[model samples]
Target: MAAGAIPATKLAYFDNMWAVQATATLLSHLETEDGRRALILDSTIFHPQGGGQPADTGFISGAASGFKFVVEDARLKDGLVYHYGSFENPQDDCVSIAKEGEEVSLYINPQRRDLNSRLHSAGHLLDICIRKMGLSHLEPGKGYHFSDGPFVEYKGIIPPDLLQIKSKELEKEANALILAGGKVSAPVLSYNEAAECCGGVLPSYIPTDSAPRIVKLGEHPGCPCGGTHVADIADIRNLTADAPHTNGMP
Candidate 1:
């Protein structure tokens, strides 16, 4: 409950997006102010909801007691990952089923993870298509990769005349690249290396001295990201892009 009580969780997903199961040491099991149970682990494969991607849902079971905790949602706050869910069978007295320092096995829903990874990867591919189509002026902005209706927003405006044509072209180019296929990679690099990989510039928000994880799709330029992605571009299978719209950019 204290601010510094637990250290930042090690992100296992960052290194291997395809891993569906992993083992971790239980750090703390607490009930939130809202009465929801939260599990903290020293390392986690669960991807939290952020950066336009939804949180992963799965289950964590204690190896010793066989107690199961259903992870309805996961969130990251102040560098700690909170696995929010209720245990399959809470003790009658309300004592936590998981104990500190106990080893637990995490099993993420593979179907959900696969879909999320594909949607997230498709967004990056769309960015590549935008640049390749010579719409580089439309600076990338927020991205919503939810399954309901995934779309990437841009900071700049497109001319009324080109809106329809550009959207079609973007969709065409994206599918073409997906068909051709290319290996996808995300590697941690020094600030300078990351900047070089990202066309000689890193976003201002990234710390100057910190090594950032850069995701690259084949020969296309890399970008700094802190999310999971597919192993190859072709894994996306197909993609469609709608005409870009603006909220209030003039």
Candidate 2:
């Protein structure tokens, strides 16, 4: 962790909250009680990397902290980052950590953050579409996609003809779901409920007994997700994809 960074404690994975305007204020120091770090910003669009998603890029600024501050890296540990940066002085009042209720203005690189958010949400939609095509045997391998576009490799063998049909059908279904204006909700479920929705067994990687957060895309698509998504499917537009093939398999 660097210096002058404010750790956001109110957010968790899959949150899509972002502030349009930047506001500077004061905040309490969690790392040290005697110390009070200037609350430089109120809201941020920076998306920290987690669940295979990458971190968001941005910058912060104010007189309390300094003339300017850059967010070099953003990450999540149990869900928080030090918002690392530098200040004019080690003990200066501007850099001195403050308690909550402190005001600050947060400036985020919106274009980059928006791109990442779209790509991540698109990935989840792809996953749901793939499963609905009766290709439950397939699992996502490497999912690499940025603001420009995204590509996902599947694990199972797919028949060439079926692949084309499935891809087209998936596009149609996904688009229809989006157009229907369905509400997307994330709800915590018990282990039993999670298993039942996942077809009798939870993925080995997911912890057992712990309540799982499930994403419901209308009445049809539902699955576990820990990434930010739009409030409605309609937010997604111009969605198109290359033909699915068996070429990526080993």
Candidate 3:
């Protein structure tokens, strides 16, 4: 099958599964009678921008036909992800489709993946940092930016004193842990262990039987996460906050 094509099932990236294989099953193939064009593939790792995250960019290739295509965009339709790409005309009489069970390789842009990974980890760090400051009432606002520079908005106003203190405290703590060479650990924990380590009950959204992955920053911070993170805290270069208010909880 052609590489980077949409698949019958969505592959989750929570465990760096994309690093191993980017191949998918050959579902259905389409083309002109003269073998001028074609579209085929089963599964893919090209994230299609959902849950406030951006779509992933990557390339696809077919070894037998020497077919290579650039995945321009990916989107979800009826719970299926479709990868859109282009290729040159063929010379064969019929547009032969790949066998239904064949596999193809998909190469994701490393730079784009790195950016998305960093942004996702940074968002989680920000959440934990806020909670550490004892601002229990504060919650993250909508419109979170995880690409390029990263930052989050609070739901309501923040007290000037609390904001100033938290701003400096979180910055200092995150940077210090980074400098300390803290490792990002993802140990699977039982329900009891997870609850004890995370103060009390797990979030309602977290599955009960699933082994929870925890991201820890030395002895200071630890939280449940399902996103990729730098091996060490030192990888995080900088962190800052702005626009603190004193109205409502965020």
Candidate 4:
């Protein structure tokens, strides 16, 4: 509401990851340093690129106004979701067409979104497989869920001799669980409640007073996450753990 300040965009996808279309109000539009115009909305179904996932691409059309903005990329900065793209028809007064408080319709590319969600959920499924296979010692680390080479890294190393054996075992276990699929749920809870859902404690990086969102796969204990995921493990279809890559970590 301030001159150049925009409020945090409510994440509509957080409540419904399967939603591809949504209605939102135009909050602000500004040009980035790179010259790309960014559209901010009161709330967004667009999942900004983060949490090991790529951004969602889509188009926004103003209601009763022939203004069209193609969303090439979306990013979050300080809680604001910036829809980065340009107007369909460029003009000197392009900004004038996108008025503040005007209603707009948002539609995401469903095929791309589904693929991203499947890949992301598979990464978490791997974490579950690791725990089930008695490899609980390997601490979960960063994950790259991009379609090109999606992988979940761990903090510990797998010995060279056992790497091949473990890879096969992991792949078998992952697919087995996928066949025995279960529902997945993500909910926002208080720090204490979230810890209980996440087995016992949350990561230290999470603030004590903050209400963290926890994603739970079926009856398994939950994990703190802030990304869209499939409604069920079965939706992941299948999983194949290619090989284990280890660094020189102790």
Candidate 4's C-alpha lDDT?
Answer: 0.89
Arrange candidates, best TM-score first: 4, 1, 3, 2
Q: Per-residue lDDT for 185 in model 2? A: 67
Residue 82 accuracy (lDDT) in model 3? 58
Off by over 4 Å in 1: 1-3, 247-250
Instruction: Give per-residue CA lDDT, model 1, range 1-250, as digits (tens).
Output: 3436999999999889889999999888888888888899999999999988999999999878668899999999999999999888577633354678889999999999999999999999998998998889988889998999998888787887777788889899999999999999999999999999999999899999899999999899999887889999999999877777656422
Q: List the candidates' TM-scores in order.
A: 0.95, 0.68, 0.69, 0.95
Question: For each predicted model, how many residue pairs clash, with residues at least 3 apart or on different chains?
Answer: 0, 27, 11, 0
Model 3 regions lying over 4 Å from their true place: 1-12, 17-24, 28-43, 75-79, 88-100, 141-145, 160-165, 185-197, 207-226, 245-250
**Candidate 3 lDDT, tens digit per residue, 1-250?**
4333544545445445236246655454554345433334556667666544566667666665455556665556555565655543443532353344556567778777666655655666677666766765776664344575456666755666667666778787666555666656656688778776677777777788877866665554456764455655566666666535455533
Question: Of 1 and 2, which scores higher on lDDT?
Answer: 1
Model 3 deviation from the true structure expressed as Cα RMSD, one decimal place? 5.7
Q: Is candidate 2 or candidate 4 better by lDDT?
A: 4
On TM-score, who's better, 2 or 3? Answer: 3
State the TM-score for model 4.
Answer: 0.95
**Model 3 TM-score, all chains together:** 0.69
